[model samples]
Structure formats: structure tokens, C-alpha cells
Target: MRPNPDAQSPGPCEAAPARKGGERPSRRLLLGLLGSTGMLAALPAAGQAPTSAPKASFGYADVVERARQLGERPFDADAARIPESLSQLSYDSYREIRLRRDKAFWRDGGSDFRLLPFHLGFLHDKPVQLHSVANGVALPIPFTTALFEYGKVPVPKGLSPSLGFAGFAVTTTLNHPTVQDEVISFLGASYFRLIGRGQRYGLSARSLALDIGGAYPEEFPFMRALWLEEPAPDATELVIYALLDSPSVAGAYRYVVRPGPTTHVDVTATIVPRKVIERIGIAPLTSMFQAGEGDLAQRSDFRPEIHDSDGLMMQAGSGEWIWRPLRNPRSLRIASFVDENPRGFGLMQRDRDFGNYQDLEAHYHARPGYWVEPQGEWGKGRIELIEIPTDNEAFDNIGACWTPEAPLPVGEASEFRYSLSALSTTGPLHPYAQTQHSFAGSDLEDGHAQGQGSKRFIVDFAGGDLAYHLGDPARVELAVSVTAGSVMTRILQPNPAAGGFRAIVDASLPDGQTGEMRIFLRARGRTLSETWTSSWTAPAAAAPPQPSE
Candidate 1:
């Protein structure tokens, strides 16, 4: 999401200021910047370049040194020279400035990819330095209004052609050989979005998440500068280098992006903090979850469901796979799953049926899920999911990121490496049956549906061996456990609607009691599904179970 132009300037990891009621930017106006493009013959000839190389030789090491040096000194917010006119442009006026495709960075030097810079305006008041690296030399990409087509807004008179660009997007022929598609974009502080062969932009990935869901206001780190390595004419992978800056930390990042059926980005981050950070999040994911089928009673919309992601999936250190269904809670809720050397985790949109969304324009069903696989053993941390209440679909209220257990020491470098996979679903990891849907309702007590005494949980599991044992409920067993109160009844039966087996759990809790429950399916001494877990809380003033008389 783009930052609010009037919001306080902070790090990208910080919680962004809430967008208020206004004529917000249109989806097409925001994403239409990147579209189909023809192939580039090659990188432009060196002699024809507009500017010479910078003093420092271009490489990953150079970026790391720059970040370290910057951290040693006090943070400077005004590093880039942005024009006052661009820094004060409104949302509608900013969108009017569109990049010219023919003047793209790698326009016809002979590469399979091209780069177009984002204009600095609206929420992007802070401009970032962009450079093109070729033959071990990094040359700056000078910004000019001539590169943009001001649709309705007039360009400011005497506008400098050297104002730094805000960010950039890359166009490539990953899916189609001749037709170029915008596969990845970098904008809005440290936020970036990536799409695979057939996926559209949905959730976003951040370089880091700092003090999110904490008592104090969060901080947002920004990518101040970036270097794009010139790719060969037949190169399949693109390498990018970035310098991250914030009031609390400074860092360098390298991303090796490979676009394919499941686009994979190998990331290496080296961070050094100016002050001690009590809580820092790594590999953060931001998404939206307005409503789903399980919460249909709470929604009054015509669409069956509306969300970018439906659940949070994690692989714990003990090799246990856990799936927690996401909800648009009535209030802010933060849940943490502690682990050491976690296998992986992600926010997934498992429900792919188009009918689930029914919106032809948004195509929410086609949103891609991003799973992060850590490259090395992270000592101890917690995967935290923060869900905030939101009534509309435009706001992103779901945030998932890994918080380190140990405090970050000042003036010391901390490093982490990971790879991200953009996929349709997280089905390959857990070959066993997986939970399809989960919902809660009033339980039937003595032929009466009692809403206060007992609660019923319905969980459906599909795929894997469940397909082999269809209609054979006798072969399936439900294993249930609870932290408090007792699981009075449990049953397993085939669900024709889900094309799988459904497990039902009915439990009774004492007043003022909250219980944590776990459920899974077992058939003939073999586990058949990933664990379904939830934290259930009873109403504060609910009456206790009455004595049988």
C-alpha cells in the first residue's frame, strides 16, 4: 500500500498511517504503469549514456560499506534532492504523471528486460537514488519530466531534470517470449510486490518489520538507493542491490530474482542498528482479509468472500505443521507461535474457486501466496500474526512477520538469508490431507441448540489419502486436545460439499475460561492432516453450565 502523503515520515517497518476518507488512488491508476512491452535489443551503448560513473566501484560490497558508514553517523532524512512541486503533488495529480515506455532505462541495448522509474509525488515524497551497473561501473539514471507524460497535470515550470526517482519496476518476458510482463515492482518505502506466470499483485513483502504491534508507534525503513545489474541479452535471472535506511537501523540487501512458474527470490540482508532494538521483525508479509465464508454471518456484502489471504501456515521446529484460519476480528488480535530454527511460514490464499469471490474485476481468487524458507538456522524467534479490525476491503489489516528472540545490539551487524516462493497454494509441503475450512457454531444440547453452554467446531480436511477413503467414515478417527475444559464429543464424517472428511469437536468451558484446542485426523494409526489449532474465548458474562436436575 502507498503511504499517506500527510502521514509522519518513518521507517518502512513501522505501521503506516491509516488512510482516511478521500478520493483514494484507483487500482488501474496505480498498477497500470507497468504493462506489455517489446523486447530490448540490448543495453544502450556506453558512449550514448547520459551520465558518467559514480566515484565508488559498483558491487555488493560497496553497498554494505555505505550502509555501515551511514549507521555510524546520525540518520539524515534529507539525503535526496526532491523538487518541491513533486513532493507536494496530490494523489490524483501524482497519478497523472506516467512513465514513457520508449524512454525506458534499458530501452534497446539488447537485453530481455527493461526498467521504468516511478515518479516522486503523493505518498512518495522521499526520492531514492537509482543506478545502472554494467561492466563493473555504476552510472546514475538521471530523472527528467521528459520521461513522463503528464496526462492532465501541467509540469512545474523550470523543473530540474536531475531530481532522483522514487522507485522502479521491471518488465520481462518470463511467461511469454515476446510480450513483456511486469513481474516485480519496488515502491512505497521498503515495500515490494512480485507476481508469477499467471498471478496478479496482492500481498506485499518488506525488507524488515520493526516494532510492529508494539506499544509505541512503529517505524518504517526506506530503501534510499538501488543498483540494478545489467543483464545479458539471454539472462534469465536479475540481480538487484539496495541500501536501507531508518532512524533505528541501516542495512544492505541483495535480491537474486528468478521468474518462472513459481518465481523465487533469494534474499541476503545485512543490518546494523544505531540503537538497541528490543523487537525486530524479519521477512515481513502484509496482506488484506475483510471476510470469508466462515464469517459470512458478519458480512452483508453480495460477494461470498473477500480477502487476499485466508490463513497463516507455519512449520515449527519440532516438524509439526500448523494452520490457523484468519479472521477479521472485532478488535486487534496478536498471536505468536514460538519456535527455534523454524522450517518456514507464510500467509496463504488456499481457496482458489472463483465462485468464492465472484468479483470478475478484482479476481481475488487468483492472488498468489508467498512462503519464506530460511537459508540458515535462526536461533530463536516467534512468527507473529497481527490482525486489525477493518470494515472495508481496501484496508490491509493482516500482518505476519518473524520476531527475533534476542535483542539486537547496537553497532553490530546482523545477517539473515532466505528465499521466497510465490505459489498458488502451499500444498506441496504437506503431502498429507490439509484443512480446507473451519467454522464455529452453537452446539446441540439435548435436541436444543445451546449458544451459551457448549460450542461446536467444524473443520474440513481434503486431498492426500482422504480422497482414497471417501465415504468410509469408519476408517477415520478424530484426535482432539484442549488446554482447558474437556472435549466432550468428537466425530469424523465424510463431507460431500468439501469432497473430504469433516471433523467435529464439541467442548464445554467454565465461565471466564479461554481454551486452546488442537485437532487432526488419523486413519489406521497414520496421521492424515495438518494440525488445526485455535484459541477460543467464551463471552465474559456467560452463565456456567447448569447442574442436571
Candidate 2:
């Protein structure tokens, strides 16, 4: 998900009103007041007497109450104000300001998990409050400049203790027992990235999506506060609570993170909309797709392929598996699959061979795919895919999410629960033969001119029950259909190298028009492969060159 420089920041935790003469309460006094309420731990002065108190209980219910109260008031867009020095830092300068690992939370607590706060700057100007929850007590983790090592960025002198933080990252002994590796990060709005063992970061999951790829400008809701529960010394999972806020809605989120070969995050969210939301996306995923096998003509770099994800995989309520190969279209493309209850969906990077990318620095082959499995009945909704044209991979141009058929009720709470998995390989997820690769080009070999809008597509399906039917190739039939075009020729043959079957189709589309083509394999009366779908946009004829006067 892209960052919004103007996104609203979360309001600060409740505190005493400003004193007389428009003077705010001192940090020590505020801490003292909070200490009395058992909401914060105050540090004793150099010579002052030690002050101790019982800690108050805190959990998901507390955050839900905060969100509900936040929704009742108008959103305060000016809650966070970044210093001019920090707000003006360039990307390179911002990178220089790194959190010191030595000062990380729970660094010496005998726990496997560590939390590192991100300094506020660059695209992440809004600061979010952080708290540490131990036993039943919640203590705010106050921000301090000593927690960061500012290399060259000219941080102004005497920054306030309440400056807060842009976000935070969670690290653990994911790869090696002694080596700490980052497993998850909450940064830039409601976006959070995850990676499993032997995998690199790619797509991101969002708490909610509003008016994305719609007529109205998209809204970015951000995490205003986060409370991390201290894990046991031998705990394998970490629990986190977050307060999300935007102009249209406020939400409370709980994430149970478990890191392993395939990392899993169990998410539960309760959202209260300030008004009726016409377009809301749940279990939203964002990624990048500059160019891939299906659209090789758009490639400019030396790499044969460039993309975080190559396709969108979905399991419909009817139990049918469908794979739609992603494309870097010349224009904006939006496709929606209407269903009552989607089993699951994800943006997958099916092509994992390094040779295809040839970019050692990027290591695109190692990017992990994220699958969202709904925990409860999502009811009637449509899985929407939005592809925005991009010339380079620096920008994320692909988005997918489930949009409910009915608008969210105004001033009422709606809850959604799902499990997100960071997958390196998804062969076991599909029961039928999967689409190995897809390629398309002009159908010049069949006596069709290159510019005549006739195209040839070669799709390979491998694995599953295809091997059992390889002995009798004739029994396997190819099923192909086009929504706005005509199929000229279709053929299915055994691909011994793939241990499955290959289907080739020659289709013609009207000039300057777009069409969708779907193909699958079947034997007898049973389907033997997942449906492979793609879209094609016939190029418009070039205009005749005007003669020079």
C-alpha cells in the first residue's frame, strides 16, 4: 500500500486539559497523574522517593472502547505535527536515522521477541503511541532520542519526550536460534509486511481499504496506537493490539503472530464507521506488477520478468479454483468476481526461478506470497482486483480485496476475522493441476499478420492428477472460452517435460477492444485443472504519419 502524506494521525491518549494561561502539563506531572490511575510507570527522580502503584488491566476490549469513542468525535487531522527538520529529510537522509538495537524493548527481558521503534520522518510523518502490556497492566513506551542513532540527519536539539514514533518492527530468532531476524513490521498507515523463513518481503496486508480504485479519492486509515503484550520466555506466538482511525471509521485490531517456515498471522478486527461506507474492502492485499510473462512487450530492463506477484489465486464458495494471471496493462483495469462466500484468495508469485528475474540485488524470486483465509462466513461480497499501469516497479500498482455487497452500517460496528499466511510454495493448497506458466504473442505462424489483432497464447498446467491421465492424452480435453472475442484455433497436447498438459489457443479481438479468455483441462466428466484466466487488450492501429509541409 502507498503512503499518504496527508493521512490523519491518531489522537493522543486521554490526558488532563491544558493548565491556565494555555500552558500544558509538564511530563513529570502527567506521568504522576497517569501513575495514580495505574496506566503508566513513572521513573523516579535522581533524589526523589520511589513511587509504585498497581497496574490497570488492559486488553482488546479497551482498544475497542477507545475506537468507539474516537468514532463519535470528528477526526482530528492535526493530531501529529512533525518537526520541519525531520519532515524535510530526503529518502537517503531518512534512512540514516536508524533505531539502535541495544535500546530495543525487551532486549534483556529473556524473551525471544524484540520491538524496535521507527523514527518519524520522510513518508512516515505521523507518530503513533506505543505501549507495553505485561500481566494486566499497560504502560506507555515513551519515545526518546537516545533509542535512535542519527547518522547525518540534522535532528533539532531538545526534541520533546512525547514525539512518539512512526511505527515499529518485531524481530525474533526466526532463521537461527541466536540470530534475530525481522518477522513483521507495522509501518506507513495501516500497512504491515510479513516474511517467513527463507523468504523476502513483497506484498503487504492492510487492516481496511476505503474507496480504492473507485470514483472517490482513496482513504488511508492509520494505526494511531499499538499495545504489545510481553511474551513468555518460551512463548512461540506474540499478541498485539492496535487502534486504527480515519475520517470515516475507527477500528480495533488484534494480531497473533507466529513465525516459522510459513508465518501465520491471525487477525481480528472490529470497525465502527462514522457514516455509511459505500465501498469497504476486507482482507486487502497490495503488491507490484510492472511486467511479467503475459506482458513481455512492456519490459524495458534486462530482467526477463519483474513483479512481486504474477497472478491472483482464488477459491470460490463453489470450491472451484481459479487463477488469473496478472498483467501490466496500458490502462487501468478493474475486475470483480461476485460470490456469496469466498473460501480464500491471494496475490501469488508463482514464478520462483531466479533465472527468470536475473536481478541478484532484488532477489525477486524469494518474495513471499500472502494468502488470506477468512475465519468466518464473509457472506455476500465480491473479490475485486485493481491493476494500475506503471512503467517501473518502484510503485505498487496492484490491489485486491473483498468488497461487501451492502454498505457498512453507519455508526455501527462490524467485525472480520482472518488468517494470513506467508507462503513460499503453495502446491498443497490447490488440489487440481496448477498453471505453471503463461505466455502470449502475435499469431504470426498461423498466417495471421502481427498487427491484425490475432494472438497466440501458450499455457502450461502441471502437477495434480495430470500424471495419471498422461498415458491417454486424447481423453484430456481443453475447455476454452472468450468473453468479447472469437477463438480461431485451440489444441491440447501432452507436455512430458511438465508432467502435465499444455494448451495453446489462437484468438482474435476487435481492434482497440479488451477481452478475457479462460482455459482449463478436463477428462471424462471431472475437471482436472484449475481455471487459467487472462485479459488481452488489442492495440489500436497507428495513425498515418502526416507529410511534412
Cα deviation of 332, candidate 1, in Å:
0.5
lDDT of 2 by residue, 1-549 (tens): 233452211111112233446664332332122112121112111122113452578889999999999999998888867787777765456556665544556766798987766777755677888777878777776666665666776656777766777777788898999987779878768888788998877777888889888877788888899989988888899999999998999999999999999999999999999988888989888877888876668788788898888999999999999999888876778999999878999999988999999988667899899999998898998999998887756557788999999988878888999999999877989889999988887644464554557788999999999998999999999999999868898999899999999899999877677899999999988999999988887777678899999
Extract clashing residue pairs from model 2. none
Alpha-carbon lDDT of model 2:
0.79
Please report the candidate that would top lDDT against the real structure: 2
Q: State TM-scores per candidate.
A: 0.89, 0.88
Give me candidate 1's TM-score against the actual structure.
Answer: 0.89
RMSD (Å) per prediction: 4.6, 9.1
RMSD of 2: 9.1
Off by over 4 Å in 2: 1-3, 6-55, 443-453, 539-549
lDDT of 2 at 393: 67
